[model samples]
Target: MATTEAGIAPRPDQAGLTPLLEVEDLRVEFRTRDGVAKAVNGVSYTLHEGETLAVLGESGSGKSVTAQAIMGILDTPPGFVTGGSVRFRGQDLLALPDDERRAYRGRSIAMIFQDALSALNPVFPVGWQIAEMYRVHEGMSKKDAKNRAIELMEQVHIPAARERAGDYPHQFSGGMRQRIMIAMAIALDPDVLIADEPTTALDVTVQAQIMQLLADLQRERNMGLILITHDLGVVADVADKIEVMYSGRIMEQAPVHDIYASPAHPYTKGLLESIPRVDLKGQELSAIKGLPPNLTNIPAGCEFRPRCPYARDICKEQRPALAEVVPGRFSACHFAQEVLDGDIEPAQQ
Candidate 1:
């Protein structure tokens, strides 16, 4: 693993690097005909150099939306980042102008989109897409950038990358396409890499390969990797920390081991129980009951109360603040301590 010392955002003109990236009270909403849907609500987390923060949640739980907001890619017509602070090395990216933010995006921070095939243009050769980043950012010659692209492809373990550099996105396999996305993400050596479901749509073997590739890359560059996915199995080995989200709010945050050992939130516990376990190989997998709250008309207090197993009147009366239940462990559950103390378990299935 690379050094974990305080990091500064890298700059061509500046000296010093700090791996600190903090998102404070991030709130995002979408204005639809139905009503304003809150996608992310007061979400906050800190990422550092060489750290892997796995964001776990079900679909529409705001995992991808949060990443979109950080990457400055949210659609403005309907999607709005109402309030937030995306700070990198002490600079809030939300405060920067469009030009500066654009510069920082691909240079200082890059994202590997979930859908690789769609992310790459159908007409352009994959290598050209990867090399375009260099042409735009580094102003490299086409031939030189193409060479760099091949090297990146090979770095991600794509075979015969020099020969396949001219291949289109559709030409490669699903796993290879994802590797291409990873190549482009790491092409600029960004300080942080937000991989939103990189392993989505892949078979089990391919998923392992992609996860290993990401782990290797993060170790190589000491990059802060924010892995957004619902796959608990992948997060177990690759992530240093885990942040569990539900109803657009962070339900729990802790080291990966701690999360697996003793979850402090009922939602998190249910998720853990849902994962197929080795010891109980044949047992049925549990599922969280009830659906996530509708963002536009979220319940009075805790959004998860409708689905939570241990919910009580107190839960209905007041919203639970994300509080620290133990050193380095945070949970938004009002009974976080009770859950951690083995006082509660998700009512089975």
Candidate 2:
């Protein structure tokens, strides 16, 4: 079995230079009529100051679920954090009181949901919605909050910020709406920012702009950023580290360039191959063979064995541990050495 690295992420409670956020042995489950679906299983990683960690995975691979859990937004009826802890600046968030957690939601940590239109209130003007953050958190007067909202709008490069501040959610284009979401998320300049698929539906140019804007904001504030998305193509230049998750567990973790150059896990290898390339135009785009497994009934042992081309008897009989494969990389594949040795084909995603 894979051994966890004592896996203690730094928190603020500790002395100096502690990590901004650390998640260790975290598990989340959802109850349904059928059974409990394990959404996150023993997932762990650390984010330092001004660092960006990009989580890449399939739609149901627990990317967003884990983020929701961190933000304290998961609905408890169906969802529960079964194990481990989420520590921010050394404070155990899971142990915080409900009211205290609510207080931390936007001021210390913030999230930009997948949909902006739904995230923003249709009845209220954009500025009112943004100002609400200040009104509620800092007790800013309405006029003062609205002026701050316009400043945020202008900072995000929204056109005619003062005028558009009065516009409703329906008035802005998709890119502009997304900017508005970013503006609100950063209003308090939270120490950590979690953007769940910030670019959902927009033209390629707009997507580039949004990502660039986020990068600039991170740089300007020196904030730790957690970018949760399925788009492997977008994170290459932005993220300092990459964590590839599958079937509620982390399959691979490494620095961004190392992961792109040579992934130690087969699933990460497959995901990399699946990226569309201009040079590979006219060739069929690669895809992982099957749909992600039903979490309620994840396969025994290695969850990815059935889909992996290099699966062996050992793979089927025993689950691989997410052990250190190299100095700075970790992979949950028994044959990680074989993969690094070029036994697996690169174009096999």
How many angstroms is residue 262 displaced in model 1 relative to the true structure, after the best TM-score fit? 0.4
Give lDDT tens digits, candidate 1, residues 19-103.
4688999999999999999999999998877778899999979999999999999999699999989998889999999998998
Q: In model 2, what is the error at residue 266, expressed in angstroms? A: 0.5
lDDT of 1: 0.88
TM agreement with the true structure for every prediction: 0.93, 0.92
Q: How many residue pairs clash in each candidate at the backbone level?
A: 5, 5
Candidate 2 structure quality by residue, lDDT tens digits, 1-349: 1111222332222345577789999999999899999999989988877778999988889999999999999999799999999998789999999998888888888999778989899999999999999999999999999999999999999989998899999999999999999999999989889999998677889999999999899877877899998888888968888889999999999888888899899899888888888999999988878878899999888999888888877887899989988878899999897786668553343
The Cα error of candidate 2 at residue 239, in Å, is 0.9
Instruction: Estimate the overall C-alpha local distance difference test score of candidate 2.
Output: 0.88
Give lDDT per model, in order. Answer: 0.88, 0.88
What candidate 1 gets wrong by more than 4 Å, as runs, is 1-19, 278-284, 344-349
